[model samples]
Target: MNARRCDDLRLTGSGGANRVMEAELKRLVMRSAFDVRVPNPKREGDETLLYPFDARVAWVAACYHRTSSRISWDLCSSAAVRLEPLFEDLVPVLSSDDRLPGGPELRFSVEVGAASDFEASPLQLRGVVKNAIVEALASRGVTADIDSEAPDVVFIVRRAGTPEARRTVVGIDLGGSSRHRRGARVATGLAPLRETLAAQLIMLSRWDARTEPLVDPMTGSATIPIEAAGLAVGAAIRHPSELPWRRLAAFEGLPGETPDLFPGTAAKIVALDADGECIKAMVGNLRAAGLTGAAFDQSIVIGQQDVRRLTPERIEALLPEVRDMRPGVFCINPPYGVRIGGERGEHELLDLYDDMGRALARFSGWRAACFVANPKFVYAFGHHPTMTKPASNANLRGHFLTFQF
Candidate 1:
């Protein structure tokens, strides 16, 4: 695509919070050397931010982003609610576009969401939209078929606005499976933290990743530690071949190589949990993410230990290299008392948070970030946080609080 055509392209990514995800995207755009035009923040209840498209944005989001769940290109939008006229308008555009995937059989999937003003059900609307697209492509001399199981391209058809002023949008999904699934942690312990949320905690904590030492005391399945290690080594979360962008002509000549597993300037990372099974799960997950042999020995240490018993002396004994290192990050996703056996009573969970705060206070100069679902954690910990960012963990809403000890 030429520069003017690129300007016509718009993209968006979905994640936990709009503000946090938008901030991360800005950082990624700057690091990738792409000029992006940021759209005004989405209105309340909106879950994504739109930006003028850059091929680098799509490539980096597919392979490197730890925040976005999925990214999509906004193909077209119209005030017309009818499917026929909307797709008919694309016939000329489709004919002239050389970037369209050229294969013997074009496998595709369609998703539809209709507003309350629409009379048709979602399933019926989806069928109408699918037929409209297939007919449109055939008119342009391009053959296409529906393959929901494994599709070369996934299209989204959505309707919005009030009855008087309705708008429909059509977009193509560039992210195939969610970006949060890093293909690691085959065994997730009870109430395990999602990898993307863990990455957000690490980013919010501002850990340098090179000189600092990271410690996760209540590291169930070691999600936070493993994500830290992955980020330090510049690991690609998704293989280049699996990305949907491979089918797009605009992404030609982009770097498709995954970096070798080398802990050149990686920081010292420690994972400690009270449960023995959690430790075993962490080991298997580390191996799955290619952190083994020399990489494991040089940068990571895993052990079973209760959070209350974690102290400066205990950490030094577990990983002696951290003794002289600079203060780093201490992040955790502790129990929320809603799920997971034991600590069902409110008092028991509060006591655990109290003990956790005391243990974390022992590490002078270290920065701490915790994800808590309960509102009482602030009072129980008895320490004012330096900053608190609203976030969500699964179905429950929570906050990520940062502290300096």
Candidate 2:
């Protein structure tokens, strides 16, 4: 068993590789029996993935079910904002699928003033919160009539402070898509997600023989990539009961359905970025997850390369070893809003996507998948999608579109 100190938690930011490392720390320690809480940063890349060092604390996570940032000033995302960082503490609890990553401004907070599970609240304030979430999401193109059960993503929130401060905690219902419905609210550190993703990757390897690598080009302090890489390394799946990150009372909230959204057998999954630093960050995260000595050995390889101009010769150079392997899958989660460059990079990305589409078209046997929120990509790819699913990452309501040749 590992012992982590609560106050000793650390957070650092580096471009590229350093970000991946941040993700690694988030995966392991959070999933394990502990979490570390550090000073939270306003920006993601500036924050640290926390892990626990003590056994007395628990972490909680929360987010708005809505996708849009502007919510008529009624729905406050302050809860998710404070909650996202707490996951590193012991016994951190979170929404199964994170919400803030898709570009919706989010926040998290602790549940202060111990109260009974079924505490009463004014009906009016409840309605306001619900309307704000639903309205914001609608702005992002999600139909209010859309199915809410077991969505690919969820937002968890908790309120911490004196009762006079008027704070409340909650999470997106896995059962239905309603802003008014209440459920358990908790915080989670990046650690648990890292482990969960690692476990998923390991299990996926059995059949597909493809290691789906998570790529971060503009790796912020390195939460997403690091956590993703940890999941790639076969980390064991664990719940918050085993670890403690913060404290919160149980909630009498609704539940929703959760299931796998990614499609494919997992052979030849590749994650690439133009920034070598981001590539290194994820690699470090993978290593920290104990992947270097485990089944992921030789199964996952990350490299520093630009997504633009992916010429066949250039592609062959990086993946020369896989020449004999069957045609694989290529998936990219590029910086849609956060790292999105101006027209110069945007044009480059569009042309690169065109090249990607052309490559997939030529390979006919290969499938390329991307998380796209841009119009130009949809126009340039020039092929019908084999499957198009709605999903969220970084608070953005995006499509998980793939082309199967």
Candidate 3:
């Protein structure tokens, strides 16, 4: 048996919210049997390094925006000598032979990050790496197809070690598509939260799927509510191993198997939106996600109501079905006035927030964890949160502030 070595792996999150992503990574590691170590932040500029120690960590890979595993920092004089042996080494270790029947007619793309002194065009180097891998596979009697542009596999080659003493590092992407694309989000609102960020916010809110209830008063496109429902109902979402990589002949682990993270617990969730168009979009998205039928109907109640007019009575009126779910979270990703289009100026936005604060005051016991772009407006809501954390979505900057009633 080849012993699993702890290679340098990189798991990506949002640009400004590494801490939130780091927290999620830790949570994922906690559920595993492996003794994984999540290192503290060591970053240059905006790039943060989150190293999770494990060889077979496909389950947690989905929670990350991108991942690069099996980092090799070995100096090599030639591309063929470097890449061929790398592919050959990975074939057995990843258990490629045990992949799906007929095996994966593989597609691949190669990217090289080397200095100019060590010359090789991206295309020329891609061809070299491609031919080397193909030849290696042929030697093992494994037939595969390689596509450069639209590939099932991606191999990244970078200069590692140090500038003074650098080595060629090769890493394989576990899958092609980012896990954030849950295949459920077909429609979106003007300002939609990234699926992973929504998941992160849900985690940060500390809602228990088995016991606590969840309500998204401004549930644009139903991303948060649908994700919560998927958690509640134990929906089968795909992971990295189930991707095209699973069809590799030497891939060993069982494909299509995900962690039983859902504990067969269903939460009472209610999603509300002021715009009729937004509610319509939410309904269509929920249906596409297979969140239908009587139970789901009772669990998730979507309707139209302006958030500005939200009151304790109005909240109950919207979801009269939430009989036992008292004092649940009102998790929302509201208009940060950055991405979501609104004609309202700064003064108007402040007033809108002020009104929202007053409306939320009516739900005396219910707490809130909201993503606010402008902290200045956070005070518009009469009460201040007990804790605050920085957050970001792509280019937009924000903070997640949790208020306890």
Task: Please write out the lDDT profile of model 2 over residues 134-164, one tens digit for every residue.
Answer: 4444455443322234233333333322344
After superposition, which runs of candidate 3 have C-alpha atoms over 4 Å from their true positions? Answer: 1-9, 16-56, 60-106, 111-150, 157-169, 233-236, 239-242, 247-251, 319-324, 339-344
Ranking by TM-score: 1, 3, 2
| TM-scores for every predicted model | 0.85, 0.41, 0.72
- The TM-score of candidate 1 is 0.85
Candidate 1: Cα lDDT at 259: 56
Question: Which candidate's lDDT is highest?
Answer: 1
- The global C-alpha lDDT for each of the candidates, from Candidate 1 onward, is 0.71, 0.35, 0.60
In model 1, the runs with Cα more than 4 Å from the true position are 1-19, 22-47, 80-99, 112-121, 159-166, 260-263, 340-344
TM-score of 2: 0.41
lDDT of 3 by residue, 298-402 (tens): 678787878888777775776676675477788888776664346557667778788888877777677788877787766777777877777676557887788
lDDT (Cα, tens digit) per residue for candidate 1, span 1-405: 100111223223233456656676565545553465444443323355556666777666666667666566666555554545554544444445455666556888887744444456667667766776676577656689999998888877666434465556566776665557777888898778888889878887888877788889888877898888866665668767887665678788887765523337657888888998888888888888777687478588888889988888887787775658677789889898775456458788899989988988888998999888889998998789999877777667888899999
- Which ten contiguous residues of candidate 1 have the minimum total lDDT? 1-10
Total residue pair clashes for candidate 1? 0
lDDT of 3 at 397: 80
For model 3, what is the C-alpha lDDT against the true structure? 0.60
